[model samples]
Target: MSNIASILNESEPAAKPAVEAGDAPAWNSTPTTIGFGSVGRMGSGAAAEPPKDADAAAAEPTKGDASAATNSKEDGPSATVPGSAAKIASGDIPVVINEEDMEGQIYSNAAWKDLGISDEIHRGLLSENYLRPSKIQARSLPLMLSDPPKNMVAQSQSGTGKTVAFLTATLSRVDFSKPEQPQALILAPTQELADQISRNIHSIGRFVKNLKVALAIPRKIARGENVNSCIVVGTPGTVLDLGRRKQLDCSQLKVLVLDEADNMLDLNGLGDQCLRVKLRIMPPDVIESVQVLLFSATFPPKVQQWIPRFAPNANTLTLKTKELTVRGISQMFVDCPNDDSRYDILCKLYGLMTIGQSVIFVRTRKSATEIQRRMTEDGHRVTVLHGDFDSTERLELLGQFRAGETKVLVTTNVLSRGIDVASVSMVINYDIPTKPGPQGDEPDAETYLHRIGRTGRFGRIGVSISFVFDQRSFDHLNAITTHFGIDLVKLPTNDWDEAEELVKQVIKKNSAQASYVPKVDDRQTEADDSKPEPAEAASQSTTSTKKEDDKPADVGW
Candidate 1:
């Protein structure tokens, strides 16, 4: 067997020299150049002597084998799995290859052509450089596109191509014979997300003849105008209104998709609207025949319990808790001495790395405006978006950011959820997200997950740097990290050069670990405890501290 194959199948560790911390080689060094075998050169080496017997190898106690455990520990801290050696050796973020993910070879290994997609849609996918189906796409597509369509509730990590998976199924199911018939209805939580999904569908189905996609937004279509299109994408309110007014013909609607399902189903804002749309559009008799597909990066326990009622008897696919966070994202945080120092540290971030496009999320609109003004002064093209902006203005500003007219976007939770800008390589949590709880305010873990999810779309490498200035903020962040069971590497504000280097190292190490959990040290905990209290600093300092506006948005979800 090849070295890699043997390594994968072997029950015993290959004896090798152990190196201590100081003597250890650089993590990024090539495996072949060091002592480990390369993936490319796997079969080239001489064969090793055969084991004495299979019975003897089986006789050894695998469970609590001290020598085996010791060898594994001495090898490295990284997790071992098939095809992970190269990534571990090269210091790239490791991806877990699950056996269940590999069970369906036809969907997992086959190309778009092999999936029986149409020529026109296939051309469009190829044009956009989507060579094959993603994991979610591969698993969900066949089930969705089957002879008798199935209701599906899929929970995937952000940016794993959930949009395209559902889109493909929707496009494929559409009957072009009745071009004007609205066959597919996709509802998003926000107008921006709805608009973005509309654009993506058009782009993917560009070559299809008689393809009609209508945006059912307030100003996009007049009040009395009828929506006669093959597919309709819109916010719940607009969709609900159109359905209620009988402007949108849902009689022939074959598919109903809820993108960002958790947000849409949240009881606070759009949930009622979503339920109204579903009820108004689908009569009791036809509801059974219509396919329902729910997609989101998160489905919290509460949401998960509620989804079966929304999409009855749906085929559910979910990522385990440890696997919820996107593997490619390198999560870190900046330790600011004071709230004022956060702005200075924010400006320095752009110079520290090559950022394609970035989003900086703050707690309030006032801070967003301030940061935008300061960032503009620093010679960066900036765009600020918030709930205060009217729909038209919000659309225009988002257009500029999406088209790369502006590189830095500053906003509140308004843009946190489902906005997919492909080139966004970084997300800055200028202020950590929090929600009111019995103990005052606690970290909003779901919102934090969704906020950072903006950048790391479809397995692309991205970074999220959160800024924490006080004990409250620090405790919130710590809680969030603990909740997700992921490590948050600390970045110092004092030294730009040292901070930059440390950030790079953290990214490499964390990526290779693949597991999001970071090993915390006692020194780091001590340092966190020693941070000066914000109230004390405020009294001693000459500059008056601006009280942050913590007024919660009634419908920010």
Candidate 2:
């Protein structure tokens, strides 16, 4: 077990008293001070701090992407702040998140603008409107761009520019001068994510000459079409399928990136599919020749089990801030009467967020479908997705969601991992997942974070409402809040009638929208098509419409 697990074991959920209405969770106790709960009070919560100990959620090794620094034994401390250090070590909430925003990190201040990279690559990033490299990129790029390339495992939260981090690494490493023969292979947990990554990378690297990148998503590209590229970003399913058919070969694969590895290992009902990908990797001799990179937002224990099986002693980097609460995003825990009441709450919440994007997460595919049907029947623009949907269907639904065609999305945990769509304003956990780690083959806290994080991104405030129906669900939320170092406010609900309006009010209070739903460009033409038409997204993006003779050899995403 990890250190967090051990610490959590020492204290039961019962240690903290119930939260008072509208109060933040207490991060003053032992083990309740990891992320946002302790940052400096900039707006409403903790105060900010200096950059000396930035504690970025994913701290890259300073030396390089090779190894960790050696630990030293200290004798006695008679330093400048022995008194202050003692207070922090004593588990005081005041020191939980020393939100010391360092104003002078080289990446934040200097170095990148003078990176000395080619003008074309720089233009590519600017054209894509990528303002700047995230903290992860600024710190790791220097090392990643240095010499024979290194195997790295970068752990950062969802939507934190991790995709670009490795994209930069691969772009710098891959020899665009040579034909594309799978010098690097990128694996994602789902087809839509793989598609998004492929598209984003293509757009960023558009200015780079002679770089042929092909996606391995189903129906997008067929095997043996004589495509060439130094990079291949794809879902595990498509990559494995191509390799098995001898259409795609990683014999010359120099780098293997398992983006969102935790999600693959923890995605609900995707264990078998993911395991098959590992089995399809280039044979033993070829596998030993490649450097591996694993990345995720949260690396809970269950998904960690796959480390030994996939990565070869991958170097681990973890960066976490002390303050754990996302003060900008007001969080609430509501007690529901039952399943029916929970559904009612979501319906009411949808009315309040009529102009904003929302997501409702369920525990299973069946529930996702049922809830989606009920909501759609009630005249809501919503869609449902789960492992049950084929790769094409899933990709299409994702397109609609990203395009803002559908105002709300109700689905299983499939979209929860590293799928970034910035417009999401609220996340409703209709059925809170209680498992800390996966059991049998269900997703864990690592996957759950992907769900809630879909909102409150890009400095925009958002809200997350979770319905706690039973003791198990309540305990799960308590454990999750304790781990994240956020205070949980519990609201009691009596019936479905009142629950609806209450849900709507909570959603409206956090969203920035004032009235009518935002108008977006949705090209589809169908009505019971109340759901975003997955067929339409696939039809427009794919070349199936061509008489098969005009199809191109390479189309990424």
lDDT of each: 0.60, 0.51
TM-score per candidate, in order?
0.71, 0.67
Q: Which is the leading candidate under lDDT? A: 1
Error of 2 at 298 (Å): 1.4
Best candidate per TM-score, number?
Answer: 1
What tens-digit string does per-residue lDDT give for candidate 1 at 231-340? 99987877877888888888888999988787676554455566667765667655657888988766654454345556664554554444456666778777677788
Q: How accurate is candidate 2 locally (lDDT)?
A: 0.51
What are the clashing pairs of model 1? 93-511, 159-458
* Model 2 misplacement above 4 A: 1-107, 114-117, 223-227, 265-286, 305-310, 313-315, 320-328, 435-443, 491-557
- Please give the distance, in angstroms, between residue 52's alpha carbon in candidate 1 and its true position after superposition: 60
Clashes in candidate 1: how many? 2
lDDT of 2 by residue, 530-551 (tens): 1222211100000001112111
